[model samples]
Target chain A: MRLAALLMLMMAAAATPAAAHAFLERAVPPVGSELATPPGQIVLTFTEGVEPLFSTIEVRDAHGSVPTGKPRLPPDNARQLVIDLPSLPGGEYTVIWHATSVDTHRTEGSYRFTVH
Target chain B: MSDIEIAAAVLRSVHVAALASLFGTLLFMAVALPVGSGTAQVRRSMRRLVLISGLAGLIAGLAWLTVQSAAIAGADSVAMALHVVPTVALRTQFGHWMLLRLFLLVVALFLMRRPGVAIQIALAGVALAVQPLLGHAGAIGGAAGAQLIASEALHLLAAGAWLGGLLPLFLAVGCLSHEMAAATCRGFTPIGLASVLLLAGTAVMQIATLMGGLPGLFGTGYGHVALLKLGLFVVLLSLAVLNRLVLTDRLAATASTRPHMRVSIAAEMVLGALVVVAAAFLASRTPGTHEQPVWPFAWRLDLGVFSDTASWAEPTIALGATAIGLAIAVAGVIWHRIRWPALGMFAAIEIVAIPHLDVLFVAAYPTSFFTSPTEFAATAIAHGARLFAADCAVCHGVEARGDGPAARSLPLPPADLTANHFRAHNDGELYWFISHGFTAPDGETAMAGFSGVLSSEAIWHLIDYLRAHNAGIAMRRTGSWPQPLPMPQFDAQCSGGRIIDLDDLRGRAALIVAVSGDEQVEPRSFDNIGAAVVVVARGIAATPTGATCIASEPQVWTALAIVLGVSLDALAGTQVLVDQDGWMRAAWRPGDAEDWTDPNTLAARLRDIQSHPIAVNMTGAQVHHH
Candidate 1:
């Protein structure tokens, strides 16, 4: 009953216009996952409408050198980007993404994934 | 339209229709559903009215869908009409909600076939519940959004009700008895008054959204259009008030004056429809809610071939840029989650500063291969050649000629690298190989641990070069290979920490070592004879060291030059000052020079400050007291 009261209090707090824009709830590959082979594309699902033009997502190797298709955009103008790697050897790869929503608010993020 | 744009347009258009359809159906139902009780003539007239109004609603929805795509996504006619109609039937995404709305409408229409006003009202109410979800309510999902959405939705419904109610009023006076007309006027007057209030409230909300407040009222397209919308509605409201106050009062006493009041109401309805059209246009515009760019970038592309990617290879961040980016990301996330949008927005804008950081850091390391997407492909093949040697050449022939003596014992066929079929495939297919294996991700898996062991990026690069090699393509890199050039070897040494001349230790082979602040050797060690010239860099030290302490590093390099019997000035074609922290680095360039060789001058200056306080003291030589 005590826990329920706290929950009720939380639920009663309304979402403000500003609070609606949330950062990524969960990034794919669950932040860090070692894959057998490279995935063809990089997908980012945001809490709001992301602007297609001004956003950039890049994949870099351990050496900090961006791959051939480092800062790639979405293939079909979708919210995801597909980076063509010249060759991604087995190593820890860092995916860095920066996006501005249609609302014109900018945000950036980074996550790591390794190739098995 | 490009595929994505086409998709977004189709989506926006169908949704507009779905939203507008609620008002379309409701207005017709309001006008056509009612008739006087216990009369067969009234029932027949009501059915005819129902058929006409329902048909009008259908026509309005079709027209709305046609214009909607053009409004929201700029989709041209025939194709758009074809696209949106089919989309509604598919019931996807926003379309799903529209379909659910349509289902409710069908149920309401079926229930209306059997006429109990209570039953019909219940079904219509249920249908209206789906109306908000058909969209236009999102503007209300958040508190502010809700206020705006509620005002807008009411504006739409109220306008429809006033216009719809007028149709019944006109028909009752023209075709029905005088008693029915009197009853209709009473119902119409209250409904019309309620609509005027809703329209006024909606106008206020739109102005709030577009102009934000007082100052913006005179600025922006949204502001201008809103002002215009408000002006028109004010005129319409005034006409409605005049009809209700003076004209409707006279309608009962003098039947001939009825036309004037009805004309005023019709004019108001026309103006209200114009407002609806403008409001629809406003909805299509970007939310324009936040001052910042909601989404930073508009384009995200991944061509399985990383080669064609925009801004791919070179990252444009500086040394301190990564830290700043990480800091911004963290701070922005924290601020956003905490409901501090203003602070979060500020931190988020720092992303612009971060990309520049990458550009600066990328400049520090030189490229291992030429950066050309096309030219470096041969290099990729060479890289693949190396990769093959490391991973595949054991059972396959070194030349890939298909005759490895050990291949006969293997269950899988050795890779036929020379096969035109394999070489001709796209990067996507080659990736399929690395992803699946030697058995072919297309075939089976055995493929070895190449995919498991090597990064896909390396494998892709290997394939790129291999493809070029297979294509028999060659590109000449003017400087990809090492080219010999003659440049000065400024490795010089100082005698007693002073600039020692090259001629002074000519026979002694004075290796003139240019001492930078960072050098590895002591001043005395340069007195040996070695084949290579030893140059000490004095000025290269990290911090500001006095010349006296720094001069020692060059002195030692000079001694080594004398011992080697080779003039530091005459060492070789290239004076290689630094061999990039490699094995040859310590041998070629050595010693630390962070300290100063000319400390006496500094010491005198310090003494002048400490002892004399404010006065400048002269040194012993400069004073020259006899």
Candidate 2:
């Protein structure tokens, strides 16, 4: 119970205020990690709330796919941004993002992740 | 010598000679020769010489301009001449001044025979003043530039009064009657003395400014020529003094003195002409005052093709010879016998030793080669920006503020490209650093080498981009616009709730400002962009509310100028450009503002800002295709 509470407290603290610049805290399937199976969605947790209007998440493999739907923010966590992915075959993939924090500071980054 | 150099030298010498002749003839008429010399033939001949010299000077000036234009174009070919001549004439300060001089010369030519000769004299003075614009004085701008030009103008005028007058004075002595010749020679003594003093004072200033230090007086080719000119000038001055104090009375008292005095004056004229030629050569060579030597000269005891190490060959021998020569000269003088040869040998040894000292210093501490760009263009910076994005941005960060994502993973934090530590390095040192990647004190490579991946030209381009950014002239990739592209128009609010339309500021220069959320405008930003500044923000009140702040609706961002498809959000930390005619010129990421604070640079930018043409994109018109 204590460990659970500590983890919860840490997550809350990690969720930065909307006024601060939003930087990537962590990502689903991990950046530069080889996954045995493909993930259904890529979740990016930022240091602050990222505005959905100007922000983007693009994923490309050997070929390319038009990502569907706007990035969704969880009701419980505004700092966590979720982009749903379609089922994919095994290939090397690159994830590119343009993130605009609630305060309107924009930052972009790219990383490569693999799915076997 | 190379063909261009030889051509340039010849043209410069002829121009100087002709200019000197014209100036000297006029001065001789005014100062030395009285109104009535009872000899119409002598006066008519002098007048004819003046006319001839003026025409020759004009021709030589034109030829010098052509050669200078070709030299700047880096080719003597007819093909390049067509393009370069127009640019040099229309764009350069030197070109503007030269045209002004040519116009003045024409005016002077028309006014030459008239009683209003003062105007012609004034025009000639102005023409001489502009000559320094072709030399080092013009290369370095600002207060230093002004100082150099002033000193050089005075120096040239004094030289014209003295050296230019010598030939005409020589002729007067030969042709005039005994009484008139003595009177002319006596009358010139004071004028000559004043001009010599002026020349001495101005020469000191020119030498100090152009020769980095005393050491530079020996180290550079320019310095060697200058010393040679100085030595000749000393000899000329001695002859002038001899004539003024001793020979003047001889011309009045004895007929025998005429031949000796005339010969002496002729010698002075020749020496003076040589000095002018040396001055021309000095201007062609780059002064060592501001630049480091490319390579230290190595001396060998035994003359050979190359000497990597300093050898005790010539310098030691020269030193011994000079000491012995000086001793012999002193002994001969004591014995009431002057050894002219020994004195001459001493002077030669002293002059030779100057270069040897420079060689020793260079061989002792040689620096890496620095290849500075002869031209810095917007296109070069754009290419550099693209390369930087591909190669360096991943590590140095997008804005090169050194906050790239990979920066966290490095053992040592990547250097902040925008920091003073990097910008402070000379071009050669920077090149060396980039070619050979950084290493830690513990001998571990901090950054990977890009030498194998990129060519030298690419590396230089990267430096240009970084240098431009650091210089506050940000380079951007692309902004695709439709032909007759509608100007991205919007209203902005300042800090104090004042709304300004984009069209309202169109008639004059203005900086459409952009800053990140909560980012305050520093005092320097205001200092750098002294013109009107309009800040962009969303809604009624923005985070940075100030007197100059402008608030617009969030959807108004669609009307904002963009670069590389970067949205208004991404443009937050960048600088936006709205030219004078309401055209969206550029949206660039600015580097540090401090670099552009140089007065000379600011003055240049001010000129650019005033003259920069508005971008007019037409339908199917030229657009930046990234």
DockQ of each: 0.03, 0.01
Off by over 4 Å in 2: A1-116, B37-39, B79-87, B293-626
Q: Estimate each model's TM-score.
A: 0.39, 0.44
Candidate 1 residue-wise lDDT, B1-626, digit = tens:
24433343344433333333334334434544344563346445554554454344344444544443332333466677566554443422234444554465465556556755455444443433344333334412345555655665576566655654554445454554444444556656666777778866665555445343322333345445566767787787787678667765677566776677567667765675666555544443333222221121122111222243564344323324444645656676676664465455445655554444232111111111112221122233445656766766666676454557677666576777555555434343455465445564455544454667777657765554344333321111221112111111121223332332222232222222344343443333322221122444433542212221222233333322322223445322112221211011111222323222333432332233233222212121111000
User: How many clashing pairs per prediction, in order?
Assistant: 115, 20
Model 1: interface root-mean-square deviation in Å: 18.5
What does candidate 2 score on TM? Answer: 0.44
Cα lDDT for residue B95, model 2?
Answer: 62
TM-score of chain A of each: 0.67, 0.79
| Residue-wise C-alpha lDDT for candidate 2, range B1-626, written one tens digit per residue | 45776677778777877776777677777777766837566777777877887788889888877776666555558678655766666555556777787777777777767874556667766776677765656544446667777888888878887877877777788888867788888878766888899998877666666764333444566667787988999999999989988898888887778899999999998888888888887776656553443433332111221243456565556546656666877776676556676666667756664455333222211223344431233334556777888988888898787888788877678888766455545454556567777777787777876778888777766776666554331223323222112234344544433335554565655555554456665322332444455665532244334335453444333234222244556656454545565544544454644334343553445447658764443211112111
Lowest summed lDDT across 10 adjacent residues in model 1 chain B is found at B361-370
Please identify model 1 stretches exceeding 4 Å from their true place.
Answer: A1-116, B1-47, B59-92, B119-151, B177-180, B209-211, B215-217, B287-626
Tell me how candidate 2 scores on lDDT.
0.62
Give the lowest summed-lDDT range of ten residues in model 2 chain B.
B617-626
Candidate 1 residue-wise lDDT at A23: 43
